[model samples]
Every structure is written in C-alpha cells, then in structure tokens.
Target: MTDVNSRPPSGTSMRPRNGAAKDAAPALQAVAEAERDRLIACAELLFFAYRDFTSDADKVLEQYGFGRAHHRVLHFVNRNPGLRVADLLHILQITKQSLARVLKQLIDEGFITQRSGREDRRQRLLFVTPKGTRLADKLASLQIRRIEHAIHAAGPGADDAAKRFLFAMIAPKDRDRVHALIRLPEALDTTEHLEQPQERT
Candidate 1:
C-alpha cells in the first residue's frame, strides 16, 4: 500500500536532487568555454589566412601605385563587364566618396572604362579595359595557384567544404543574394552580343 505522504506532490518536478545540479554547473560552463575558445582560434586563423592570401597581389598592386581597392575593382569589373556603379557600391559596401576616388584612378590609368546603359542612360556601367583584364587575370592567376595548392593539400572534398564555409560566413540577410550572384552564368558569356569596348560617354 502506497502512503499518499510518501508520494511526490502532484505538481512537483522530478529533478536532480541533493547537490547534483550544482555539481553539473561547472562542467557545463567548462564545455561552453572550450567551445568559445575553439571558435576564437578559427577566427584568428581566418585573419592570418587572409593576410597571406592577399600578399602576392598586394606587391603587384604596389608596383602600379594601386592597392587592394584597385585590385577588387579590377577583378569584379573584369568578371562582370557592364556592372552598374550602384551595384558595385552595394557589393563593396563603401561610401560614394571612397569609390569615386578608386574609380577615377582606374579610369584615368586606362584600366577600367565606364559606359551608359542602353536602356537607362543615367546608369553608369563599368568594364575592364584590355589592360585591366590582363592585370586582373594576372592577379587571379597568383591567387588561383595558391588556392589550388591548398585544395590539393586538403585532399578530396576540400573545395566544396571551403566554398560552403565561405558562403556560410556571409551575413544571413545577404546569403540569398550572394548565392544568386555566384551561381549566375559568367556575364561575359551572356553579354557577348554587346560591344565590350564602347568608349565611355
């Protein structure tokens, strides 16, 4: 026979008794700290990796009296000819003043050209000149060799894993837009019908 007083109260929670909860607190905290440390290490590794990755191109850009901004402008304009000024601003996330300075330098140096949109005359389209294309290709080749070597060292599936990691690093709000941009067919292939070398108006 069960005595009603011996039973747990109807609303009482079945929980760790005696000092069990207190004993587990330290263990849980330790696990959280360890995970935080691991993430911090990964963040530091990214900083070091980016420094080395851009070093080679930085030297070449220095020779041309340019910098990372110039390299980025050249790269995107080369890849997506006819990219709009507003779109480039969004991609770079820089102030109009900053971009104006960079764009003026590239245009003056004969590396990049600007054109007006056929449909929207006010739209300023950007493209890399033949000189710009060569420079962009050269910079890309240096980075590609480094990436290829790293991927080979990382073994099979590294490329896919690396891409997934990079995509995940993008902001949650920007992920869908970035995914669309990367997945699009090469702009050159699709825009081949347009005259690529039109003089900037």
Candidate 2:
C-alpha cells in the first residue's frame, strides 16, 4: 500500500533547470574581467611613460620660471612660423583667456612676436624669436632623445606602430583635423629636425 502523503521520490534529477547557461555565465564574466584588467594596465603604463617623457624638459622650464603652457606655446610657434592665433586656439582647444595669458607672457618676455595677418588685419599671427627658437630646440631635443631611445628599444616598425596607435587614440571627429594639421608642409618639414640638432645662431 502506497501512502501518497508519505511517498518518497526514488529517482530525481537535482541539476538546475538551465545548468548550461549558469556554467557559461561565470566563464564569460571571467573573460570580461581579464580584458578590463589588461586595459587598465596599459592605461597606467601610458601615465608613467608621459611622466618620464616630460621630466627632462620640465627641469629646463623650471629654470626659466615657465610651465608646460609656455613650453607648448613656444614649441608650436617655433615650428609653424606666422601661425594664426585662431588656428593655435583650435589646435590647443583651450579657452581664449588662457591662451591670452600665456601669449602675453611670452611676448613680454621677448620669446614671441605677434603681427597682423596680411590678408586679414584683425587676425593675429604669431612667431617665435631667435631666443625662443633656441629654447624650443632645446626642449625638443630632450624629448627627441627619449623618443629615439624608446623606438630603438621597441625594434623595427615600432615608429609606424606607435604613430598608428596614437592616431587611433584621438577622438574620431577630430582625427581629420589633426591629420590635416600634421600634413601641412611646415609640420612635415619640421619632422626632419626632430632627429637632427638645430643650428645655433
């Protein structure tokens, strides 16, 4: 006699209803975590690399009582003589007030000169003085040495790989503008100087 209320299950499966899905979830989670960790490590390396890369020029800038803003202003003007102030603002993507402060400092210190554009009198054109040129060259040489050393250590094709990586890092919308700027004749011509010492005047 079987008592329904006291009956015991002789054979019953204990597995979860969707055991396969449950197992796959943890595996997918592990892969996602690994990828996140790898990306974070790469980002940290960039931070460290930038710190050391700027360390050399930072010392020289400190001697002149100038900061990174001044260095950037000097570098661009030295590279692109007679650049428009508007164009510079676009390239830097900083507020006009900020640029004005740095520009005034450089101009007052005799490191930079400004003139009216021939075609547009209202347009301010910028250029670096000979003194500024020397400083810019010095800063560039410092960074260039570090870059060349890194490239050598990275082996063949490293330069191209680095350029591609950096280019891809830029925002998609701005990539075309950046590409055009670098492709300018002046910019392209200056590329040769990065590997050679600029003549002292």
Candidate 3:
C-alpha cells in the first residue's frame, strides 16, 4: 500500500550509512583529483614556456632602460607603420593612461614618432623611428631564433599546430578581429622593402 514516489517520513532514513552512493564517493573524488593534477601540469608547462620565450627579449629591453610595454609598442609600430593610436589601444587592449606613459618614453627617447592623421588631423598616427626600427628588429631576431629552434626540435607540422593552438586560445568574439590584425602581409613581411632607406626631403 506504500507509494514508491513518496518521500521518506521526517524521522526515517532513505539511504543506508554504507550504501552504493557512499562507496562511489571515493571513486568520484579520485577522478576529480586526477583531472586537477593534469590541469596543474598543463598550467606549469605553459608558465615555463612563456618564461623562456620572453627571457631573451627582457634582457635586451633592460639595456635600453625600457620594459616589455616599450617592446610591444615598438614592435607593432615598426611592423604596422602609420598605425593609429586608437587601433594600437584596441590591439593591445590597454587603457589610454597606461599607453600614454610608455608611449611618452618612446617618443622622448627618439624611438617613436607621432604624426597627425591625414584623414583626421585630430587623430595621432604612430610610426617607429629609425632607432626604433633597429631595436625592434634586434628584439625580433632574438625571439625568432628561439622560436625556430623550438619548432625545429618539435619537427615538421609543429609550426602549424602551434599556430592553430594559439589561435584557438583567443576568445571567440575577438578571434576574427585578431585574425584581421595579424593577417596583414605588412605585419609579417621583413624584406628588401623594409630595409630600404627612407627618402627624406
């Protein structure tokens, strides 16, 4: 006469103290612990990889009395000449105040130059000075050698896999924009054209 769906009375227990549920708890806990260990391993690997990747550049920057921020600003400006301030802010995803501080140092040090935008005089366009270009190239070469060695050690197809992995790490909403920003030939090309002396009037 008892309904199967009825709840147990307030004073009565539905599950035994040593039931199947209690027995499975340890198994679930073990699985969770294993997964956490795997995650920690991956995290540590990424931390070490990034540390080594940037170490060479960090040493170079120190000689100039600059930091990573200066390196990033110089790199982008050198690669994308006439880049707008607004675009740099968007690409770097940093606040105007932070950009201003690093930017002022580069400008005062003769590593960067700003010109009024032809389309909008109110807008400031960024360009790397000759000194900036040399420093940027040197910094880039150091990093490139490290990357080439890593890729070579990883063997064929490793470069493509690494690129895919990095692209996938970008947020879905921002991926398209990132692709557009990074896809430009001007950004990647370092050829005779770039090495040509600027024609000064």
Candidate 4:
C-alpha cells in the first residue's frame, strides 16, 4: 500500500483541491491589469504636471544663463536661511560633486554666500544674497500663481485633499524627515502626524 504522505512522481502535474489554483489565475490577472492601468494614468499625469510646472522657471533661469539645478539651490537657500551644507545634501539627495558644481557657480556669481556655523565652526551654512532673494522670490511667485489657479480650479476643499494626496505619495521612510524639515506651524499641528490644517485662503 502507498503511504498517504508520498510525494507525486517527478514530471507529473498535480492539481490543487477543488480547482482553486486554476480558478485564481484569471482573477489575479484582472487585478494586475487594473493596477497597471492605474499606475500608468498616475505616471502620465505626474509627468505632464511637472513639465508644465517647471516651464516658467526654466524660461527665467535661461535668461540668467542658469538651469534648474541653480534655481533649486537658490530657492532652498532663500527659504531656509542659514541652511547647512549637510542638511542641504539630505534635502536635495544629490551627490556632493553635483552640488559643488552648482554651488560654485552661485557663489562665484554673488547669488549665495556661505559662512561658518556659529556653534560648529567647521560646518558651512548657506545664505542667499539680496540678488538671489529677488530672483528666487520671482521664480516662487510664478509657481505659486500656477498652483493657486490649479487648486482653485480643483474646487473647494481641493487644496486640503491635494495636500493629503501629495504627503501620502511620499516614501513612508522619508515622510517623518520631510515633515520635520518643513516645520509646520504649531497651531496647525493638531495631529501627531504632519497632516496640516487647511490655510485660510
């Protein structure tokens, strides 16, 4: 008599009980196809949105013989005065060599200045020059207008919904760090997480 636990012979196909395994293939395929469609839609929307969003800034930067890299460094430096190089690296997630090239151009053109850290002398803290501030503010205002128009078109409560969506889209591991970096106001910090209250338009 054959043992109840004996394995199936090699080269033989084994069917799962009740044909469940065979039935699951189509269901799994349908789910995968649906997910793929959703992802494709999201990816296309993001691509178009980013392309249009950066166009205005790109035009302005070209006039100054600068590129997006310069604009980014200038913008961050302007927003976070006394930004340390290390912190900038963390925020930008770029290599030191890439940052150095852009930073050198800005520094040489008098768009940015660096000074030793007050507490830690070895740390280089970055600040935007007056000229840099003007340019950065201009670039920001252009983007802000675009964002405002888009949010308004999206309808009431759209701004809050959009913010939630954007925050959720961030990588889980980096969300906490990003929240801390942005530093939402205390009154708006009702949640333990970084879901901020809607701004009074």
Candidate 5:
C-alpha cells in the first residue's frame, strides 16, 4: 500500500491536488484519492504556517495602532510606488468600503499619499511617503527576519525552495505580480540575517 502522506517517488507522476489544474497527473483513481489526502495535509500545515507568520507582523502593527490592512497597503505601495487604488483593490481582493476605511486612515495619518492620476482624472495614484516607507520597511523587516532566521537555520537552498513553493501557490499571472512584490530569490544575498539593530532617529 502506498503511503498517503508521502508524495509519489520521483519516477512516479503526481495526482491532482484539486483535479482543477491542467497539469494534474492522477494516473489512476486511487492515486487521485491519495493526492486529495495529501492536499489536505498540506493545507493544514499551511494554516499553521500562515498563522505564525502573521502573528510576527501583528505585534509590530499593534505597536503603531495600525492593523493588518494598513500593513498590506503600506507594504504593497512601498514595493510599487504610484500604484493605482484599483490595482491595490485587485491585489488585495477586498471590498471598496473596507479598503477605503483603512486607506483613509493611512492618508489622514500621512503615511501614504493619494494623488489625482494624470492619465485618468477619475483615478487616484498612491505613494508611500518617506515616513510611510520607513514604517513599512520596519514592519517588513520583521517578516524578513523571521524568514531569514528560518532560512539561515535551514541553510541557503531551503530559502529558494520555500520561495518557489510560495510563488507556485499563486496563479501564473499573479506569479509575475508576486515576483514584483518580492525579490527574484537572488535577493537572499543582500545581507546575512543577524540581530537587527533598533532604529534611532
């Protein structure tokens, strides 16, 4: 009997995790069933991984009285300055009213700037101010450090592999979008992870 948990050995083709993707290779019904089981296990692990990851950022966000929405807005804006509000809505997939509440707070606080679009008078282009960038960078460093610590603890190849898994989970079109927000995996070399110094300015 094949182990439900172990992925089929390299020589064997993998079954569909959802039977939705074009590339799913469930050669037999039994293999397909096993693949579904494995998918559930992966989902369970992901739930915990995401929970832990967000918790790390949550602490930082709380210190500034900003919530996760603020963090997401700032993070994306910093990554791609002058992004449109519509693009942000598409990226976040949140309702306009919800996003408006969070964005209005950030704009009111001077963390982000929304300018009238030159191309489209009806559209608003967003940018993170220097202050916003600093805060976003600091918040981002928390996750970066967490990932860096895990990667360093696991060593180099593991980091690349983890990033590949994350990108693979995203839709192909969104893969390019995800790549824009993050480095091309080579960014792991910028600076070795160590105890980060506190900002003093």
Candidate 6:
C-alpha cells in the first residue's frame, strides 16, 4: 500500500481538517471535494440563469393574463401536437383541478382546441390554434434568439456541453420520461425552432 503521506503540497483541500493531519490527503478525496464544490457553484448559476431566462416570457404572459403555468401548458402542447390530457398532466405533474382551470381558459380564449379521441371517448386530444401559435411563436422566437446568441458567444461546443450537463441533472425518477422525449424525432427537429411564431414551411 502506498503511504498516504506523500501527496504534493501544491494541492491542498478545503474540506474538514481531519483529512490533512497526515502529510498527504487521498487523491480521491481531493477530486471528490473539487467535484462537490463545482456542483454547488453550478447549481447556483443554473438557478440565476433560469430566473433571468424566464423573466421576458413572464412579462408577455402577464399581458395575456396568463402565468408561467399557462405558458408551460401551451408550449408543451404546442410542441407535441395531439397530446392527450392525461399524458399532459403526467408530464406537468400538476393537479387535475389546476390543469382544468388553465385548459378551460386557454380553450375559451381560442388559443387551444380539444378533440375527442376516436378510440377512447374519455380521452381529449389538444392542439394550438393559429392565435395560440402566433403567441407561442413569438415567445419561442425570443428564446431561440437568446439561445442562438449564447451559442455564438460560447461556440458550438457549449451547446453539446450544456446538453450533457442537463442530462446529468435529471433525477432518476424522471430519467425515463426524459429519455422518451429525447428520442422523439419531432422534439429534436423543433428544438431549434424556438421562435415567437414558428414559420411552418
């Protein structure tokens, strides 16, 4: 066994002092500590970035008398055309009552339309109308531009790095759902379509 007392002095640790009493700390301990610190700092950065990223959309939603919840419902439904109510609620993880209220308002506003499923009478398939498409297009356009600018600033490598980081952050329970989404051809195709009003060419 290699003596634990031979570590290079250049690499000191910020962890609790117990590991350092000996001349050399375990190399693995240093690596773990560095990773742990990076994760913590990255978490804070993600929190701040998400807040700033959503602020513009929040303002637009407020003008339409909707909230972030409504934007989320519309955006997902818009992306996945003909999605069922049950599946939507599952993805959103919101109570039926809450979803019902938002769905009702969106339908009433002519932003979304619901059609009965041919196979299952109880199932309702939803889609966004031209009006909703317009709004969603605008909202999405802004985000696309933001993302494009970010990519330009950081170079294409950053986009792949960001995706890797995001995939790693998914909770174990949500991994299956995320996998299903990632495998979607349409999802990948439209992911870059992030415009306020997507051009349907």
Give the TM-scores of the predictions, in the order they appear. Answer: 0.82, 0.82, 0.79, 0.79, 0.69, 0.73
Better of 1 and 4 by lDDT: 4
- Total clashing pairs in model 4: 0
In model 4, which runs have C-alpha deviations exceeding 4 angstroms? 1-24, 185-201
Q: How many residue pairs in model 3 have overlapping backbones?
A: 0
Residue-wise C-alpha lDDT for candidate 4, range 84-197, written one tens digit per residue: 999999888899999999999999999999999889999999999999999999999999999999999989988777766776677666776776766754443324565544
Q: Write the per-residue lDDT of candidate 6 for residues 1-201, one digit (tens) a residue.
A: 867787746777546576455546577679878988997998899898888788878889989899988998888888888989998998889999999999999999999999999899888999999999888888888777877787789875887667655655565566557667646433333333333333543
Against the true structure, whose lDDT is highest? 4
Give per-residue lDDT, candidate 1, residue 180.
64
User: Candidate 4: what lDDT?
Assistant: 0.87
Per-residue C-alpha lDDT of model 1 across residues 118-153, encoded as one tens digit per residue: 999999999999999999999999999999999999
For model 3, the superposed segments whose C-alpha errors exceed 4 Å read 1-18, 184-201
- Clashing residue pairs in all predictions, respectively, total 0, 0, 0, 0, 0, 10
Q: What lDDT tens digits, residue by residue, belong to model 3 across residues 87-126?
A: 9998888999999999999999999999998888999999
**Which lDDT tens digits does candidate 2 get at residues 1-201?**
777677457765545559787998999999989998998999999999999999999999999889998998898889889999999998898999999999998999999999998998999999999999999999999999999999999999898778766766666666667777666334233232233334644
Between candidates 5 and 6, name the one with more favorable lDDT: 5
Give the poorly placed runs of model 6, Cα more than 4 Å off: 1-35, 182-201
Q: What C-alpha RMSD separates each model from the true structure?
A: 10.6, 12.0, 12.3, 9.2, 14.6, 10.9
The TM-score between candidate 4 and the true structure equals 0.79
What TM-score does prediction 5 earn?
A: 0.69
Q: Evaluate model 6: give its lDDT.
A: 0.80
In model 2, the runs with Cα more than 4 Å from the true position are 1-17, 184-201
